[model samples]
Target: MASIQFKNVVKKYIQGKQSLQVIHGVNAEIADGEFIVIVGPSGCGKSTLLRMVAGLEEISGGEISIGSRVVNKLEPAERDIAMVFQNYALYPHMSVFDNMAYGLKIAKVPKDEIKARVDKAAGILELGQLLDRKPRQLSGGQRQRVAMGRAIVRQPQVFLFDEPLSNLDAKLRAQTRLEIQKLHRELGITSLFVTHDQVEAMTLAQRMIVMNAGNMEQFGTPEEVYSRPATTFVASFIGSPPMNLLKNAPGGKPGQLLGIRPEHLDIGTEGWSLVVDTVELLGAERLVHARVGDELVIIRTHEDQGAPAIGSTIRAKPREDRQHWYDASTGKRVGP
Candidate 1:
């Protein structure tokens, strides 16, 4: 395991004499054995940053270090890192055992040592029984595990996963997520995972980096980011239905944005009267969509609480302590 550091890393692409900057100065410290997720919307540079760490993309400015060594100019293989790509990247003609043993073979490791390592990784990944199967013979989740098995055998200082769960069905994605968490626990390897899924970021990450258009928005534990968003972008992005950021919101001063989470709002007798636009009954909870002034507000309620009729007026209030204030011009958080 190793600590990874990014010191004002930057990336730029030159196209027809135009230099388009994709990643701004991104800086963060990942501790040894920590799992960090880089999450953002598509085109937001999450994958770009991960690729830079893997040496798949070049750094345009600043430095990246693994452990105490500055790896800015080091080749990918020399950095001692293992990567699990989204597509599994398994060879169709090769069996699971051969695929996992390929890297060690290329390095010319002794035959006995290679078998021991492959067997160990396969055992850990529960692929021991499927060692002779080709890529086409395995299910999506099984193929993904084989890809992970390939990486585990390398025993690198760091592990890089690039949307490794995207191809799986929803049920399999959830199952594989739990398996990855277990793997991290048992092996305690430093891992950096990149994905566009906020749920994955919140669930899998010990800490996470939230980005937007190449700029780092916020980096923290899921609780901190969700509870106290540093900026409007994070406030709107991290939540399921998203938080309500109203311009000239009720009980807010002019030129300030009032923010409140859906669950932090409640139907009450005194407060803003919301004109109901729609209501969605989720399994255990209900989501009510209504308009306050000219802004839409979403309120989460227990299904047992029932729901108001569409087009009817419902009174609601935001929990006093849960209110978030933001600067209207900068869109950054401010004191209430």
Candidate 2:
């Protein structure tokens, strides 16, 4: 295992005479054996950053280090890293055992050692029974496991996953996530996973790097990012249903935005008066969508609380302790 470092890493695309910058200066230190997820929306450069670390993309400026050595110019094979792509890149004609052993065989490893390594990886991934099957004979989840097992047998210093769960069904995705957590616990290899799903980032990351428009928005634990976001973008992006950012909220302050989560607002007889617009039933909870002085706000309530009538005037109170303040002009957190 090895620690990775990014120092003012930048990426730019040069076409003819014009240059378009995609990745701004990003700096972070990843500890040895730590699992970090790079998350953002599509076209946000999350995958580009991961590709840079894997030696698959050229760095426009700054440097990347693996362990104590600079790897900015190293070939992908020389970086001692293994990559699992979104698609399961398995050999269709080969059995699982042969597919997993191909890398070691190409490297001229002893035949006996290759067998041992393949066997160990298969055991870890629970693919020992399916080793005799070809790629056509395996299910989607099984094929993905074979891909992971292929990576594991190489014993790389770092693991790079580029939205590896994007193709799996929802149920299989959840199951594979747990398997990955177990794999990391047992092997403890340094890993960097890239995805657009915030839930994946929150659940699988030891620490996460949130990216937006080629710039890193925040880097911290899931708790920190969710509880105290650094900017308005993070506050709105990290949560389900998103936090409400009100410009003309009650107790108005010029050039300031009041931010509050849906769960933090309580429906009551006093406080800000709002007209209910719509309500949604989501199994155990109900979401109240209301308008207050031309601004929309969503409040989360238990199903037992009963949904308010549409167009009915109601009062909802924002929790003083849970309120967030932001600078409307800059979209930045300003006060506690």
Candidate 3:
């Protein structure tokens, strides 16, 4: 295992005489055996950053190091890293054994060692029964496991995963997520995973780097980023159903935005009377969609609790300490 460190890294693509910067100056340290996830919306440069670390993309500036070795100019193969891509890039013609052995063959490892490694990885990934199967014969989740097993068998210094679960069905994705977590726990390899899914970032990462528009928005543990967002974008993006962001509220500065999670809000007797625009009754929870002063807000509550009728006025009460204050102009968090 190896620690990965980025020092003021940047990437820019030049197309048609236009230099579009994809990654701004980013500096972060990912410890050895740590599962660090890079998360953001599409085109936010999370994948670019991961590719840079994997030696797949050229860095425009700054330094990158795997362990103590600077790898900015090293070939992808020379970086001692194994990467699992979004699409399972398995060999359809080769059996799973041959596919796993191919890397060892290229590296010229002893045949016996290669067999032992492949067998161990296959057992860990539960792909032992499908070793003879081709990529086309395996299910989506199985193919994904094969991809992971390929990475594991290599015993590289770092493991890189690029949205490895995006191709699977929702149920399969969740299952595979747990499997990946288990794999990480068992192997304890240094990993850098890139995904646009915040839930995956929150669940898989010991620490995560949240990026936006090529800039590092926040870098911390999942709890810190979720409970104490550094910016309005993070507060709004990280939560399910999103945090209700309201502007022009009393006790806040002019144009300042106040953000509160849906669960933090409650229906109370005395507060802002919002018009119920829509009501969605989920089995366990009810999403009371309402309009408050031209802003659409969603309140999440238990299904057992009665909600205000549609078109009826419901008082929207805010949570005191849970409220997030953001600067009106910059959109960055203003206070604790």
Candidate 4:
């Protein structure tokens, strides 16, 4: 296992006389055996940053060090890292065992050692019974496991996953997440995973990097980012229903915005008056979408609280300790 470091990392694309900067001076220290996730919306450069670590993308400036080596000039193979891509790139004709052992075979490892490594990986991934089956014969989840098994056989110092769970169904994605957690716990290899899904980042990351518009908005554990976001962007982007940023909140400061999570608001008799626009029942919870002045706000309520009628006027109080204050002009968190 090895630690990864990024020092003033930057990326830019040149088209004729114009240079478009995509990643702006990102710095992070990933400890040995830590699982980190880079998460953001599309066009946010999260994948670009992961590719830079994989040696697939060139760094326009700054240095990336893996372990004790500066790997800016090193080829992907020379960096001692294994990558599991989104698409399962297994050869169609090769059986699972052959696919897992192919890299070791090319490296001229002994046949006995190759078999041992493949066997071990197969057992860990629970692919021992399907080792002789071709990729076409396996389900999507099984094929993904084979891809992961191939990476495990290499035993690289670090692992890079590029949205590996995007292709799986919801149930399969949840199951595979558990499998991945187990894999990390057993191998204890340093891993960096890239995803646009906030749920995946929250669940899998020991620490997460939230990116926005070529800049890193925040890097911290899931609890920290969700509880106390650094900027309004982080506050709004990291949550499911998203944090509500109200410009005309009751008793609000003149130049500041008040932010609150949907769950942090309580239906009360004395507070901001809201006109209900819609109500959605999601399993055991209810979401009340309402308009407060011109701004829309969502309040999460338990099913036991009952749903309010559309067009009905109600009062919702923001939790005193849970409210977030941000600078209206800069959209940055302003107060403690």
Candidate 5:
């Protein structure tokens, strides 16, 4: 296992003669065996940062160190990191055993050691019986496991995953997530996973780096990022339905925006007047979309609490304890 340190890392692209710097000088520290996720929307620098760590992309400035060794100048193989890609890049004709063994074979590792590593990886990934089967014969999740097994046999200092579950279906994605968690617990390898999905980041990360438009937005545990967003972008991006930012609303100061999560809005008979626009029943709970003045807001209420009718006027207010304040001018969090 290895700890990764990023010191003011930057990336730039030369579009003709003009240089466009996408990743700013982003700094972060990831402890040994920590599963860190770099998360943001599309076009954000999350993948670029991960690629830099993997030595797949050139670092325009600053330094990246893995295990106290600066690896900015190292080759991908010399970095001692194994990356699992989004596409599950497996050889179509190769059996699962051969696929997992291919890397070790190329490295000229002893046949017995390769076999030992492959067998151990197969058992850990629950692909023991499927080792003889070719990639073409395996299911999507099975193929994904094969890809992971291939990486596992390497026994690298760090593990890098680039949206590895994006191709899986919803059910498979959830199941694969559990498998990944179990794998991490068993192997205890330092991992860096990149994803645009906020839910994945919140669930999987021990600590996550949130990015926005090439800027580092916030870096914290899920709870800290969710409850105490350092910036307005984090407050609005980390949640499911997302936190609401009410501009010029009641209880908000001038030049500041009021931030409250949908689940934090209490529905009652007396408070801000909201015209219910729609109600979405989601099994045990419901989401109430309502118009409060000109801005629309969503409130999550349990089914037992009852759903309000559409087009009905209701009263809802942001919970004082859950309120977050952001600077209107800079979109950064203002007060606790």
Candidate 6:
């Protein structure tokens, strides 16, 4: 386990007298055994940042350290980091045991120690029985487990996961997420996971870094990013169904934009008059898509709760003090 620190790190790609900056002077501190997830849309440089930490991408400026060692100049292998890729990247012909043991073998670890580590990781990932199977013989979830097992055997200072579950089905993704959380608890290895999925970041991260356009937008606990967004981009990006932002609405006070989560907006008889456009019943809950003033807002409610008919007007407001204010010009959060 190790504490990871990034001190004003920057990365730029040079192309024929032109330089495109991908990461702009980012700084962060991750405590030992902490799970940090970097999340953002594509082209936001979240993956680039994670690769830098793993020593896969060179830092253009500033420093990166693992534990007490500055690893900016260290080779990826010497950085003592294990990365699990999105594609799993397992050899097609190798058995699971061999795949997991390859790293330890290359490092020239004792055979007995390699056996011990492989067995432990396979057991933790519930892949022990499939150790003799090749990548072609396993399902997507199984293949993902092998990738994780490969990383665990290294017992590196930090574990890096680059969208490791994106290839799985929804059910498999959720189940794998639980498995990962359990594995993290069991091993307590410092982990940095990068994903574009807000759900994964919210569920897996003790802390999350939200990046946008080559810059750090917000870094905080999932709750902080959701409940009190530091920026409008964060408020919009971090939630499922996304937060509803209403501009120029007639309310208690004049505001540029009002942000509220779908779950917080209630179907009521006394608020902004909304023209119900659609109601999507989702088993235990429903997502009501409607128009409030000139803005589209989504309201989530229990499945038992009824929604107004299409083309009908209804009243809606936040269930609690869940409204957020954002500056119209800068898209930054303002006073509630």
Pick the lDDT winner: 4
TM-score of each: 0.98, 0.98, 0.97, 0.98, 0.98, 0.96
| Clashes (N, CA, C under 3 Å) per candidate | 0, 0, 0, 0, 0, 0
Itemize residue pairs with steric clashes in candidate 5. none
Error of 5 at 328 (Å): 0.2
Residue 24's lDDT in candidate 4: 100
Task: Please give the lDDT score at residue 9 for candidate 2.
Answer: 96
Which residue ranges in model 4 land beyond 4 Å of their true spot?
Answer: none
**Candidate 2 Cα misplacement greater than 4 A, ranges:** none
Q: Across residues 1-336, which tens digit of lDDT does each residue of candidate 5 receive? A: 899999999999988999999999999999999999999999999999999999999999999999989999999999999999999989988899999999999999999999999999999999999999999999999999999999999999999999999999999999999999999999999999999998899889999999999999999999999999998899889998999988967666999998989999999976799999999999999999998889989999999999898899999978888888888999998865
Candidate 6, residue 213: CA error in Å?
1.0
Shift of residue 66 alpha carbon in model 2, Å = 0.9
User: Which candidate, 2 or 4, would have the higher lDDT against the true structure?
Assistant: 4
Query: What are the per-residue Cα lDDT tens digits for candidate 6 across 26-72?
Result: 99999999999999999899999999988889999999999999999
Q: Write the per-residue lDDT of candidate 4 for residues 1-336, one digit (tens) a residue.
A: 899999999999999999999999999999999999999999999999999999999999999999999999999999999999999999998999999999999999999999999999999899999999999999889999999999999999999999999999999999999899999999999999999999999999999999999899999999999999999999999998999999999899999999999999999897889999999999999999999999999999999999999999999999999999999999899877
Point out the higher-scoring one by TM-score: 5 or 6. 5
Q: Which residue pairs in candidate 6 have backbone atoms (N, alpha carbon, C) closer than 3 angstroms, thus clashing?
A: none
Which candidate do you rate higher for TM-score, 1 or 3? 1
Q: Residue by residue across 1-336, what tens digits does model 1's lDDT show?
A: 899999999999988989999999999999999999999999999999989889999999999999999998999999999999998999899999999999999999999999999999888889999999999999999999999999999989999999999999999999999989999999999999999999999999999999999999999999999999999999999999999999967778788899999999989897888999999999999999999888899999998898899999999988999999999999999963
Tell me the TM-score of model 2: 0.98
lDDT of each: 0.94, 0.94, 0.91, 0.95, 0.94, 0.90
lDDT of 3: 0.91
The parts of candidate 5 lying over 4 Å away from their true place are none
Worst 10 residues of 6 by lDDT: 248-257
Q: List the residue pairs that clash in candidate 2.
A: none
lDDT of 2 by residue, 217-322 (tens): 9999999888888889999999998999999999968898899999999998888999999999999999999999899999999988999999999999999888
Q: Give the winner by lDDT: 4 or 6.
A: 4
